[model samples]
Target: MFKSGLAALIIVLLANAEAQFGVGPPFGVGPQFGVGPPFGSRPPAGFGLPSLHGDGFPGPHPRPHPFPNPRPLPPPRPLRPPRPLPPQPPQFSSLRLCTTTQLEQDKCLYALDIAGNNSIDLKLECVQTDSFDDCLQAVQTKEADLVVADEHEYLKARSADLVPLLYAHETLTSYYIAVAPKNITLLELSNATLDVNAMDERAFHAAALFNLHRGHDLCDQAAEGDVTIQIIDSADYDPTDDELLICADGSVLYAGDYDYSECNIDAGLELGIFAPRPYDTNRSFTRLLQNVFDTLINSLGQESEVWNFFSDFQGTSDVIFKNDTSGFSLIPVNRNGVTEQKFTSLHCDQVSLDH
Candidate 1:
């Protein structure tokens, strides 16, 4: 009875232990605890703890670690250099021109306006004075750079140590024609009375030519002339059959049957822009003036619609330029082909009589 009771007690204790654990092989019988495989035998599925290899399956699901390995970063890019600055414009000199009259001052201002509108690189300033002589003095003292003057004034400018830099080619026909009877000749009029209506530059030029022909300086003074000369201001004088008219030649004049070309004088005269004698040696300023002249000539047609350079203002016959001026010429009076032939006969000091 005692042995039976003890056996039943032992069986009850074994059942309780099995329930707490699992019905698998003994702990160290088939595969050692936590070992990879059996010694020389293939291991069963899920025989050990969960692994990092191949899906980590047949065991408990894998729990990710608290921290993971980070990926490598790429290399940084190099920095670029800064940009450069832009260039600047050059400096230029200013040109000053002298004006005697109010009309001339206005014309110079108008020219400045035109140059500004066209973007021309001209820095022109107008210096106004009381008289034309004052203008010449201003140019001499460096108060002004240039002045516009006529042929008569050009001679005066030369006496003041100024030189002609540019000249206007007069559009009008400039000839001093001597008209007389058809039978009259130039040499036969040496002692005969010749009529000049005005004591002007034309008369002086005619007297110069007559004195050259008469082989004597008989008509140096404009009003004082030889017996061959006569002023037509007298009312007693009438148009005689042999009366000679020394007048300006033009298409309107009717010199019928008279060979006027036989005793004609080419008044190679025009307005000139005079500057100080030192300007003739300034190459840069000369180039600048030439460039300005070229720009003016090229823009004439366009500028005429806005402002005419050759047009008169305020009842004036000629303003800045002569009304009859066609264009500007760089060639000097003595070197110019158009005037060289006629200037040879004038007996001027500057002119070469040869060729």
Candidate 2:
């Protein structure tokens, strides 16, 4: 045991000595870890096979070969001096100017850089479609040099860098309802029946006005009983009070289909259309319709030609938008409306700031 102990001590000391000189396993001496090359000198000879020669020259250092003819850059594109961008394109033919309605037709037609009438190039061939956004895309991509559109459209054109020339329809020609069905009655207020069938929100408002104007006064004297005239909303209307084509007593149902011809009205039927009277004290219905109609048509520039387009659309020829000629000029030049449903019915010409 004593001899074994001596051998173990000597073995440990020798391992520590070897570790100090880095001649043993790396971790045999922790403190010796940082003891390395003092200067930029490499490892002493025989540490490992020399990757480099003892001579100043590098061992197997890569050498350069003779310049094997450098490839030329093809003569610098022949110095063409820009060529003036091809005159900014002389009228981009086959390009389309997409816009809608009477108002935005001009914005899609030209670059703002060249919007002046003097500089405007009408030579540019343009096919007009119905979306202002589409028109702007064409111009932005240099596809269409110009886009002619409504005033509102030009205001919204994406490229502010473009120029716009204002072309306006001096007069606004809108439409109104003269005798739509809804304007015939208070809708649900009274027991009176109307001869017509359909109408709009404005017509509904007129119906309220008609009833209010007719009753609340001397006209009320006609119905001294429990019958009273009150304006009711369309949603509140009761079906029983809404008898279509009610023939009253002494009504001229047989007055014939055409009132111009002969027809005798039954005197006791309790339902009939009143005759057109000159005084028309109860002509509140017609008056209400007239006011709405005037506002709508006059708003649309109630001139005869414009008026005819609205109410005279027999649609005898073209298959475009339907001709709703109820006595108004219905020119299609349709643009987008606030809601898609309100396109024709609610679309209108708005005020614009022209430059």
Candidate with the greatest TM-score versus the true structure: 1
Which runs in model 2 stand beyond 4 Å of their true positions? 1-96, 99-130, 158-160, 172-355
How high a TM-score does candidate 1 get?
A: 0.54
lDDT score, candidate 2, position 101: 41
lDDT of 1 by residue, 1-355 (tens): 9999998988786576455432434445544565444533434545432233556443455578666876668788777776666543322276788998888898778888887887765567889997889999998988988888765465568889998888776644344554445354545544545566444555445545544544554323333223444432222334455555553331212334333333354344667888888777677777766666565555542245655667676778677776766677877543222253343345454432221
Q: Write the per-residue lDDT of candidate 2 for residues 1-355, one digit (tens) a residue.
A: 9999999998897786554443533333233455644322444545532456547543565665567676766765566666555333132123233444433344223322232334422222334545656556655655554444432343345233444321222222231111222233444324443221225433332232333333432123233323232323323333332222211111222112322112111110000111122212334433442343343334332243323222222324211111332231212222211121222122222213221
Q: How much is 91 displaced in model 2, in angstroms?
A: 6.1
Provide the clashing-pair count of each candidate structure. 0, 52
- Against the hidden reference, what TM-scores do the models get? 0.54, 0.20
lDDT of each: 0.59, 0.33
Model 1: residues with Cα > 4 Å off, grouped in runs: 1-92, 118-123, 185-187, 220-263, 301-303, 333-355
**What's the distance in Å from true for residue 26, model 2?**
99
**Candidate that would win on lDDT:** 1
Give the least accurate 10-residue stretch of model 2, judged by summed lDDT.
264-273
